[model samples]
Target chain A: MEKLFYFSDLFGVAVFSITGALMAGRKSMDLFGVLVIAVITALGGGTLRDAILDNHPVAWIRDDTYILVATLAAVGTVLWVRLTRPINETGLLVADAFGLAVFTVIGTEIALQHDTPVSAAVIMGVMTGVAGGVMRDVLCNEIPMIFQKEIYATACIAGSLVFIGLLELGVAAWIATCLSMATVLLARLAAIRWRLSLPRFHLLDRI
Target chain B: MEKLFYFSDLFGVAVFSITGALMAGRKSMDLFGVLVIAVITALGGGTLRDAILDNHPVAWIRDDTYILVATLAAVGTVLWVRLTRPINETGLLVADAFGLAVFTVIGTEIALQHDTPVSAAVIMGVMTGVAGGVMRDVLCNEIPMIFQKEIYATACIAGSLVFIGLLELGVAAWIATCLSMATVLLARLAAIRWRLSLPRFHLLDRI
Candidate 1:
């Protein structure tokens, strides 16, 4: 079970790192900038989860492998994107969706381990899935997609509920995790395909 | 001593909030964005410190007044800057310097209260002084000023050391806090004037 979880984490890291490197490439940043964004995107979400839980020796600092994998993935992506100008945006979105799904489940699992309530776990899951992308967007000087596109966080929340429901139904941990990831991926992809958006409050108009 | 520290924290929040609003104005962000950035810049560092320490009911969350003041300051600054198109960049810099000094001391003091080691406290102090700006820059989609500029973090480090040394010498808390803040302000202003930079590692080349 633990090994399965670890593998999922590694997969998520690679996907997020590639996405981050692609973002940097879009900006035509130097190699250093690409590496920085990639590493941050891969590790930022988990780091926040650990810190909030007061888990000592943050995830990346404890396991150097995560950093190593992210760096390699980032460098490779940068080179690939450079060699092949105009990488497919659709492909990147699919990868990002996969990363978001995996990370949301992992984050919820970690929060549950810490004995956080279901509500807290759901919030943490959304935070974990979105934070890395938010950090990447901020570094790239773009408005975070999370704030503008409510579907991003909304998908994570939906997945968290599915995970909790599966657990209540006595489903095995692995099965529950897989189902949660699938839910998030499906929801996110659907939203993107249909351009679904939450109702904007438009406080400005009210004022 | 606690009273003085609270006062310093209040002042720091106001100063940083103003600076954040000013930066938002420069970017031509809407008033809502300006307010968000201001509150984030003012409270972000302390919120991070508290979260890392696992202090429940985050500082700003517990004390609504802090959020109110930061919001008011942000709104006022945005309106002021809008009315006065030719903003005074120099004045904002000076206020930011003062904010850095005060925030550094407040952060170090909080760490000390938690009985953290001197080295840890120093690191926390620097994090508290700079994390908000890093966050602001990230949200603005720019490389964090901390990564680009040397003097910013350097000044915090120097001030933290002075704070620790004063404690070792049995200096009064209020006096030590004042001296440390002064040191930070002076070092930061000088660095900005002289354009100091750390030697870039350029790890990519080695790799």
Candidate 2:
């Protein structure tokens, strides 16, 4: 079980790192800048979770493997982009969906283990799934995609709620995890396919 | 002594919150957006510091006063801007300097309490002082001032190193705090006055 958890976690880290590297590459960031953003994108969410839960020695600082994977992913993506001349946007989109799904489930599970209220757990799950990408986009000097009505954070919230609800109903952990991940992955893919997004919530000229 | 620390901490929160509110105002953020930015700006740095140091529950989560002060600062700034028409650049600048100085010294002290190595302590101090503003800038979709060769993070670094050095030299806690805060305040104010900044570190399009 622990090994499965680590595998999924590292898998999400690698995909997110690639996305981060590609974003930095597009911005013409230096290698160092690319690596920094990659690490922040891959690790920032879990770090936030651990800090909020008071779990010491944040995941990256404790394991080292996460950082190592992120570094490799960043370097690998950069090289691929350099050689290919253009990014595979579709592939990137698919991988990002998987990353979001995996991260959201893991975050919700951790929060549940800590016995936080459902609302707090849901919030942490969304933060974990989306905050890293937000940090990445922000560091790259862009508004976060989640803030752009992209159905991003909403998907995380949906998956997290479903996961927690199932666990509350005494569902097996493995089954619950699979169902939750599928929910996020499919919902995000559908949103991408249909170009679905929430209406912009502009506060009309109160200024 | 504890009262003094609390006072300084709350003061820093208020000042940073105002600065955040002002920035959000410039971006034409709605009242709700303004408040969010204000809270993040006030609390983001210390949150990052505590997370990195493995301090759980973060300060604001542990204590309600930080959130209260931030809310008041945000509302007050928004009201002030609405009533006054133009934000007072000079007043905001001075208060921001104080925020940076006080937050830096306090962060250093906390890290020392955690028994971090000197380098880590200094890093936590700088992060605590400057990261909130970085987060504010990012959320407002602006390039962070610290990243733009502004003498912001440098000032934090200078003050933090000085504080830790003094503590090592057996300086009284209060004296070290005062001196360190002064260092940051003077350095930042001078930077603003003279328009001093670092040379831009452009990565010559290796992509």
Candidate 3:
């Protein structure tokens, strides 16, 4: 179980790195900028989660493996894009959905282990799933898509709540993890397919 | 000295909150958005720095005073702007410089206390001084002003180095702090006045 968890975390890092690299490419950023953005997009969420929880020796700094995976993934993305046709948009979206699911579970589990309040744990889970993408969008000089009406963060929130609820009801840990991850992945993919989104905030219009 | 440091930190929070609220105002964000941005701009830098240094119970979480100051400052700015003429642009710039100076020194000092390597300490200092603004700019859908032809981060780097160097040379703690803060403030203000900037990266253009 531990091994699976670790590898899935690395998998999340790689997928997010690809998304980040593609965004940097769109901006015509140089190789250095591409790598930096990719790494940040991959690790920024977990870093913020640990920092908020005061988890010592943040993941990448402690293991170095996560950083290596992110760097190699980023470089590989750049080479593949340069040498071949652009990656399929739909494929990238699916990979990103999986990444988001994995990260949200891991973040929630870690927060629970640290005995954080339930509300804080859920927020940490959502932050873990989306903060990296937020940083990536910000660096690319765009409003974060999550804040823009995408059902993205909503999926994470639902997954986190389900995970916590299942655990509280005495479900097996692995079963809860798997079910919750599926919840996020399916929700995200369905949203993408159907163009679903939360209603846009229009506080100013009302005022 | 501790009391002085504490007050200056709160002052920095207030100034940064004002800048954040002002930026949100420019975007015509509603009150809730303005308050959210202001709090983030005020606290985000320190949060990142402490997280990087593995400093536990992140400053604001350990004490709610910081959040209170930030909230009040944000609301006050909104009220002031609504009731009066627009804030003086030059004055806001100067206040931001002071906030940068204080945050840099505080970040460096905290890192040193943790026995972090000097290089990491310096990086933390710069992160503390500017990460919030980076986040603020990103939220507002703009490339960070610091990244785009501004000497903002350079000033933080200089102040952090000066602070560390003075301490290494056995300067009194208070003197080191004061001189370093002044270095950042003066450098930033001068850069603003003279439109100083680092040469833009043209890596792709050259290739």
How would you encode candidate 1's per-residue C-alpha lDDT over A180-200 as one tens digit per residue? 999999999998899886643
Range of the 10 consecutive residues with the lowest summed lDDT in candidate 2 chain B: B27-36
What would the per-residue lDDT of candidate 3 be over residues B1-207, giving only the tens digit for each residue? 999999999999999998888777776665655766888899999987876676877776666788789989988887776666556879888988999999999999999999999999999899999999888988988878889966989999999999999999999999999999999999999999999999876798677
DockQ of 3: 0.15
The candidate, 1 or 2, that scores higher on lDDT is 2
- What does DockQ give for each predicted structure? 0.11, 0.15, 0.15
Q: After superposition, how far is residue B165 of candidate 3 from its true place, in Å?
A: 24
Tens digits of per-residue lDDT for model 2 on B142-190?
Answer: 7787888559889999999999889889999888889999999999999
Please give, for residues A1-207, the per-residue lDDT of candidate 3 as tens digits: 989989999999999999999899999999999999999999999998887887878999899999999999999999898899668899989989999999999999998897766666776798899889888988898876666645788899899999999999999999999999999999999999998876332223222
Q: Name the weakest run of 10 consecutive residues (lDDT summed) in model 2 chain A.
A: A198-207
Give the C-alpha miss distance for residue B27 in model 1, angstroms: 12
